[model samples]
Target: MNKTILSLTGAVLFATGAVVAQTMAQSTSESTVAPQEADAASVARGAKAWTNHCSRCHNLRSPSELNAELWDVSVQHMRVRANLPGAVADDIKAFLMSSATSTGVQYSTPGQGGASVASFAHLSPGDPLHGKEIYSQTCIACHGADGKGTISGVPDLTAAKGRLTKTDEVVLTNIIKGYQSEGSLMAMPPMGGNPDLTEQDIADVLAYLRKEYDIAPGTE
Candidate 1:
């Protein structure tokens, strides 16, 4: 009887240990996946809000232009003017802060104005196929499916003396730092309002724009 009791106790303890270990493993997996999913969702929502509301006022500032703390303060101040809901503003803040620190791109201060031609020399030639994908996802909203301007102030990519008439360096820098066209009410936001865009992505998009729109160097 004594032996049976001891055996029963040992089995129960072993079972409990197995159960606890499994629970911990499950928790670990969930904790890892949940934050990644939540962060992506938050970034996406913030990108949408930024493109829709913030672009209405002026150019979209580059994430590299500000520190996280400054972004927080700026967003809070703009929240009132943009009439963004508290939750939406928070999401936008999350996106800005995340992008500001996350991208490995070298940052220049806003006071410096913009990037120089030599600064972008390391950029690889763009791949049109991949550029098409980026254009579809992000640029399509304002640039339209046909490379024409969807919004009133957006320059037509197909026009002879339009946006792409400039050299690749000029276009790339403008895209990275953001640009407001002369006499236009709205400005193109930095990184095309998508913080996830990389230098390669911008290159690809430029290649696609040239190919699809038949862009040629126009007389300055």
Candidate 2:
């Protein structure tokens, strides 16, 4: 009976060890992705939810409309009112915070001849790395991985003298509000169909495009 008891104890210990090892492996795998990437993924989800659900009721408020404190209170109140799941609400709030107008995100614009101007100098520079991640998630569908249009009539982002040559304000505004190229069959959706994308997201994406395609000011 002592041997039987020892055998059972060993079996239980082995099973427990296996479970712990598996759990640790899973956690390590999850930890490999940076928090920013995880957050960007969450923002993508929130963008979908915000567009599908929140817009159904009324016009969606701009992220710049409220401060972070106000957004927290508003999101909490709306979660209860709309019966939004806790996770969804949290994502929406995250979206709002990341894109908040007051966040002061900015990027520098380089002219063709190597002159650097502080474009949107009021805000901090957009993250090109983060922008690439967003582009992969959102823009890559229409704009190919190469920044060239994948579908028919889509603009080639690499054009030596094309859209990127336009002023920053014009480009940014066109994206925020959605624009249909004069000859295109369809208009590009606002925020590239990800409503949760912040102005920062757009800026990041623009920066990514400019850098990835080498389309700075006069160079375009």
Candidate 3:
């Protein structure tokens, strides 16, 4: 395991109390809707621009990875880091927030550039309600409704949470690109076999898993 990645991701999970409180306080129903309106052309234009510019530096994480406010912070920080123009950066930020519209459970993790939210800042306690839907769509086939595996070599989630030493980062990163466990023939396929799963979708599913299994928060 990469120690740096582990420590960084761990810190975000540990610091959620403050961010969540702040977000809920600031995000009133009226206040949220006004700033959240997306430009008619922002999504399409930003998506194209993101692929063209941002992908050059890092893996193209789905827009849902960071919340809009986090995205705003990241884009501004990156604008300076990457020397991006104001107009172009705004478009990129637009694309991100459109795809991953905030559900008000705001959590900020460390950024990719330094200790701020940037290219890699992700982890929302996530919406367990929405996560349940994603779980049914993607993970139900193999993991089942109760989180018990239906096949050989598959670990049951109820018990698997206790078995793994490194929970959140290890599991999440694997979901993105896929990986083989330390001693298993059954390699976890990328996106858990759902090719269309976005990073945000995966985050939701993880939130469900963490809640259902009582995994993430105090595990480490």
For lDDT, the strongest prediction is 1
Give me the displacement of residue 185 in model 1, in angstroms.
Answer: 1.1
Candidate 1 vs candidate 2, TM-score winner:
1
Per residue, candidate 2 scores C-alpha lDDT tens digits across 1-220 of 9999999999999999999999899876787564423276666666556655676687666555677568777988999999999788877776665555432221222233332333464545667899899888767755778878655556788898777887765567556655556555544555765566877788888888888888775423
Error of 2 at 73 (Å): 34
Query: Mind giving the per-residue lDDT tens digits that candidate 1 earns over 62-120?
Result: 55568778988899999998888977887777667765653424234222354454356
Better of 2 and 3 by lDDT: 2
| TM-score, candidate number 3 | 0.42
Give the per-residue lDDT digits (tens) of candidate 3, residues 1-220: 6999999888887778668877776665557567643463554455456656775687655455677689888888888988888777877777666545423211322122222222325556567788798777556644667877644455677774342324455556655555445455444445654445677777777787788788654333
Per-model C-alpha RMSD: 13.2, 13.7, 21.4
- On TM-score, the stronger of 2 and 3 is 2
Model 1 alpha-carbon drift over 4 Å, by segment: 1-115, 217-220
Model 3 spans > 4 angstroms off: 1-120, 160-165, 217-220
CA lDDT of each candidate? 0.72, 0.67, 0.60
lDDT of 1: 0.72
